[model samples]
Structures are given as C-alpha cells and as structure tokens.
Target chain A: MSTEIATGRDIALIDLLDRLLHGGVVLAGDITLAVADIDLVYVGLRALISSVATAEENGVPLP
Target chain B: MPEADDARLARLKALLAASAAEDAAALLAEARDAAREEARSILQDVWREALLEAAAAAVEPRPPPERRRVRQEEGTAVVEPQPPEPRSVPQEGTAAVGPRPTEPRSVPQEGTAWWAYCVVPAAEADRVPPNLDSVDPSGPVEIVTCGELAAVVSRVPLSEYGDERLREHLEDLAWVERVARAHEEVLEAAMSATTIVPLRLCTIYLSRDRVEALLEDQAPGLAAALAELRGRTEWGVKVFAPAAAVAASASTEVAGGSAYIERKRSERAAREEAHQRTNECAQDVHARLEREAVAACVNPPQRREAHGRDAQMLLNGSYLFDDERRSVLESIVEALAGEYEPLGFSIELTGPWPPYNFVLPSASALS
Candidate 1:
C-alpha cells in the first residue's frame, strides 16, 4: 500500500499539473480565485515549456 | 539596487552639506562619479532582472516577484525564519498529527481561509495516515467531517491564494512546484488509508463551516463517487516514439541534388506514416489495457515541451484497476512494452495513485 502511494513521487510536474488542473473533484464555492487565471497559467506553462524545448534543441543555455 | 544607492547618496550629501566649500565640491565630484558607476551596474542588474521576468512570464504570464537579497545571501544564512505572527503558531497538540479534529484558531488574520486537500468517508477518519514531512510543515492537516464525509484541510493565507496572489504565485515555477507537491502529498497520505476524492489544487473556502456545508450538501454524490472508487487505484501509462532512432534513420546520406530532394520527400512521407502508425499502436495498446481494468480514460497527448523530452508522446492514459487486478495490469504493461520496444516505441507506467481521474462529483451535486 505504501508502495502504491509512493509511486506518486515519480510523477512529473507536467503530468501532475494535467491531472491536478484538468481532472479531480471540483467543488464550486464562493472562493474569489478565478478559474480564468488557472487557464492562463496553463497556457503560459505550455508556452514556457515549448520555449525551453526550442532552447534545448538549439543548444542555447536557459536563463 | 537604485534604492539602496539613493539612500547612501542622501546620507553622503547631508554630510557634505556641513563640510568646507572646496572639500565639499571635491567630495561631491567623487560622489557623482561613483553614482555614475553605480548607475551602470544598476542598469545591468535591471537588464538581468528583466530577462528573468520575461522568461518567467513566457512560461506563466505574470510579473515575477522582485529578486530578494536573501537569494544572494543564501550561502551565508541557510534558513531564515518567517516573521513571528500569532497565526504562524499552530495551537498546541495540533501540530503534526494525523486525522484528529483540532480546534480551529480564529486568529484575526485577514485574507486567509481554509484550503481543502481531499475528502474521505467518515468511517476512515481515524485511519488517515501521517503526512509527508515537508508538506504544510507549519500547519496541521486536520480532518473536518460533515455527516458521512471528512475533508482534509489546512489554513492558507488568502493573500497567497487570492486572485492576484495566486496568479503571481502560479507564474513562479518554484512556488507552483512547492504547492502542487504539497497538495499531492496530503492526498496521497489520505489515499494510503482509505478511498478519497482528491480535490483540485487551491480549492479554498472562506471558513470551516463552508467546507462542512459543502461536504454535507454533496454527501450523496461524494458517497457514490467513493463507493465507485473503493478498492481501486489509478495507473498512468505514457507511450513515446524514440527520437534518436527516428532521427538516425532519417539522416541516411544521399548523392546529388535531385536524389537528395527525392530522399527528403520519401523521408517526410515515412515520418508521417510512422506518426500515423504510432497513433494506431497507441490506440490498440489502450484498448487492450482497458479490457483489463475497471475503468479507463485517455487524455490528450501532452505537449513534448511539458516533459522536456525529444520524443513525441503517443498516448497518455489513466486506468482504474481493482486491487486484485494490479498484477494483471503490470503484466499487460510489461507485455506491451516488450512488444513495442523493437518498433522505436517505449511505454512508461506510473501509479496506483489516488483515483484522480475517476472521482467526479455528480452533476446534481453542483446544483
């Protein structure tokens, strides 16, 4: 049982983000945080990841 | 940097105001020269900061927090304790315990609220396991039960999770990493003990009563979801096409312009065909795995950038499997890997995670 739970440690940030943001049990409440902001962050993450990938491909050192 | 320099110059200017006229003139000239040098260094610093902020913004569109001196002085002082506040201290005996109910402190800290990590059946309240060491290190992860369901929750400053703060924090990779890991850690701990419906990251409620109200209102749906998820765990499988082998095969040399052009066209066609074949292979593998699991879902293939890998992802699927079927699922994954490895395809299996993909609150629960 411990091993099963421990496997979550191996999950990559992107994969974790995918499930954390897109799936899971969402309980809508009066909390003021915007879902739109999360979507923007997701978009930004995609852009950032692609930029990093392009940098890696070109052998350019990331800042 | 400019702020510090301005303060220093102001002090120097004041002292020079009382000095001899000629001496003050000489001193002021030297100070002016020093200020110019300082300005150049400050410009460079600003440029570097701009570059870093731009990079961070490209990843998550928000202004990065100002670079702090603590980061520069990191080697000198390894740990800096946060400012002492009444809210920082967890009430006695409430610190670092499993699912016991602790009195919620009504500290008048503004813009802070309860962030729920997960909800489990009330029957499993006592069995909620201890949390990971670094997660919510300063707060207690207590369970608040409403009728049949118990929610795992902790206090979070609303300033950090409110619209503006959360947006800024989400843009910062380090902050997101810490919070996301902590969120998962609590869920994993509760999951180790019993069936739990893990909530999405940053699920905040204004008060404990609100949290309990949510649990109460959604009790039936929550119970149903938990029942469906009982004795089951989720497994993730990602399939990738080997980049190195594909690149190697396409790099074969050819003679003359016309021959090179012909080879390039054929290579393009081959690559397209390989991509199509990989997709079909992925679907076939997913279908086989689905047969062996209780429930399954295929998420859209993740962007290559997210994984920081050169290979193209062919499949990103999650399967919910019964405890008894764990071995069968592992063997199927093993067989698929063996069958696919020779064709420049690879499969990575993860979890027995909390059934993140399977537990959705029924539509009626929301209303």
Candidate 2:
C-alpha cells in the first residue's frame, strides 16, 4: 500500500478497457444485440489492448 | 466537466423541447431499433401495451397509473409524495415473462440507434440520478421501463456507432478510451444510487421497444441476477513482481568447471522451487480474500504491453462482496499484502466496479 504500487489516481486505461471489453452482462442470441456485429469489434479491441500497452510504455500521450 | 456540461445541458434542453413538440405529432415512428434495428418509438403506447402484457406473466402487474406517476418523477414535470409500490419479490423456478410478442421491428432513424448501458429493477427505476451524460454527445441518459425491469439507455447516432463504423473506431485506442471512459462514467454514476446489471460495451438497439423486448425475454434471468446482485460490490486485486525476484539468487565465487556444473544444477532446482512458491503465494492470496467475498475469480495475468510494468504480473483477481463484507475483504487483502510484500511482490487493489466480473452467474462460475 505504501510503495506507490497502490494507485490512488483513477485505475489505468488498460484496466478499464480490460473490464469493459472482457467483462459485463453479455446475453446470448441476437435478441438485444446483433451478437455478430460486435464479434470483430471484440477482436479489434484485443489488438488495441496490446497497442495501448506499448503506447503507455513509450510514454505516448493520447490525442 | 461542469463548464462543458452547462452548454451541453442547454443544448440537451433545447433538443428535448424540440422532441417534446414532435411527440405531440408522432410517437410511433421508431419501432424495433434492435441489433437488427427494431427500435420502436415509446411510452404510453409501447409501455402500456408491452408492460401490462409482460407484467401479467412475469413478476407482478404494476398498475399503469402508478408507473406513469413514476415516470413523471424522472423529470421536471411534477414532484409529489410518491407511494412505494409493493416490493416485487421474484418467484424462483418459473418462466416469468409474457407471451411471445411480435417480432421486434427494425425502424431506427437513418442517423441514430439506442445504446443501452445497464438494467435496474423496476422498483429502483425512479431513483436513478438525473442529468447524467451519455456516450453520445447530445444524448442525455434516461431510463426505459418494460415490465419488472428497466434499461438505462440513450440514443447514439448511427454514423459513429454503426456496426461497421464502430468496428473501425475500436482500432483507434484514443477513441476506445474516450468511449470506454464515458460508458463507465454513466454506469458508475447510476450504480452509486442503486444496484445495476451492466451491459457490455456497444449494446445498441433500434428502439426502446427492442430494449423492452430484451427486458421481456430476459426477465427471469434479470430478476434472478438482480436478486443476487443487490447490496453487493465487485473488487479487483492484482499482484506483480520482477521476474528476477522469482529467480534463484546467484553468487560470483564458483570458478572451476566441475564446480560451475554443480552450481548450475543446484540453481536450476532452486529456480524451480521459487517459481512454484510464487504461484502458491498468488493462489493463497486469492483463496484468503475469497473467504470474505460472496464470489471470487482469478483472471489471466496481464501482458507487459497491457500493464506497462517492469514486473511480471502474477495475479489478477476479482471478488464480489456484500456491502457489509467489503471491509472484511479489505482487511484480508491488507493482511495478505503485508505478508507477501517482503517476498518482492506488490499487490494492487482496484474496484467498487459495477460487478463486471460477477454479472453472469453461469459465466463467472464456469471460469
């Protein structure tokens, strides 16, 4: 808790993305979401997750 | 946030004024706007028609007049001493939804789609804090009720949120960051006052009708899930340590060939034991914390690119605890962290999140 490892600031962007993309109430079927339309988006986010990791490491500021 | 929101709020007010004027003229225009775009236009027409039918079979039939009064309390129309509706305790082991309704219609306007954020029980619907901003710039957050449940949704323009366009945007990290933050912002605000079952990112529909239909079809699961979720909070903890810390200690004294060979063998054995111990440490921490949680899980370690840390992640755990139990969970995490810190491990706690990991009973259980 004391070595600056416990962040008091907001959680990292990657952490939020991890939960938002990977977690939450997902139902099956096309009833509410055309579950197919977003499959590629999920895949796309997987790639972004890695890119975000790189950007943060390089100290890249998001526009 | 406030300065910008002032202007946005003004614009939102004007937009509502214009829509209110239009509502006097046409209300049945946007049927079905579901994934297939079945977003029907709303309220008295759809709410009464769908709610009464669905309520009859689902939980309890809420009187239409009472529900309408609840809607008024949502805005500046009129505030009055409200009657607490009978608490609708769900009946377990029953298919509590109404008859199969007509196929949801796909009638989204050329430019906009309904983006639903989360579900709250109908009883708590009126208490949703107001003036919340949505993912859509001009779209103000609002609740659309069906039967025993209601969805917190807003209109997102299709130009930006359309399936093809949304997929394109997901590749842009900045765009994802902006939307992801905003999406969480809305849910976070709403969840503060009430229990909410959050939908994943990008849950768009054609109309509130389709949103209602989702409420109808999923009522049983929704009620059951809400029952389990009420008064509970989700928490996450991650542990990281340098890879070298998990490696055997090295010395510079051995120089002979046979001595070097013996050193290598012993070092390999020590390294194997260290790795094993490190894993046990992670498991032991999660296990101890889980004891204080209503639900708990260990997710895959995040990649270096994901966390940007020099230390390799050993644990990424999420736990759901009853509100009263959160302090007990924290004490457990504190005790574990203090015990593990001297071993070169650092534990980070993150949450009060919207039960993201605990949302699906079946999903979390299987994992």
lDDT of each: 0.65, 0.62
In order, the B-chain TM-scores come to 0.65, 0.66
Worst 10 residues of 2 chain B by lDDT: B68-77
Candidate 2: TM-score, chain B only:
0.66
lDDT of 1 by residue, B241-355 (tens): 6664234342335353456546656655665566555656677778788778777766666766677777767677888888878889999999998898888788999886777
Quality class of the docking in candidate 2, CAPRI style: incorrect
Model 2 clash tally?
Answer: 24
Per-model TM-score (chain A alone): 0.67, 0.37
Instruction: For candidate 2, report its TM-score.
Output: 0.65
* Model 2 bad stretches (over 4 Å): A1-9, A28-63, B1-109, B246-256, B361-367
Highest DockQ against the true fold, candidate: 1
RMSD, model 2, all Cα superposed?
29.1
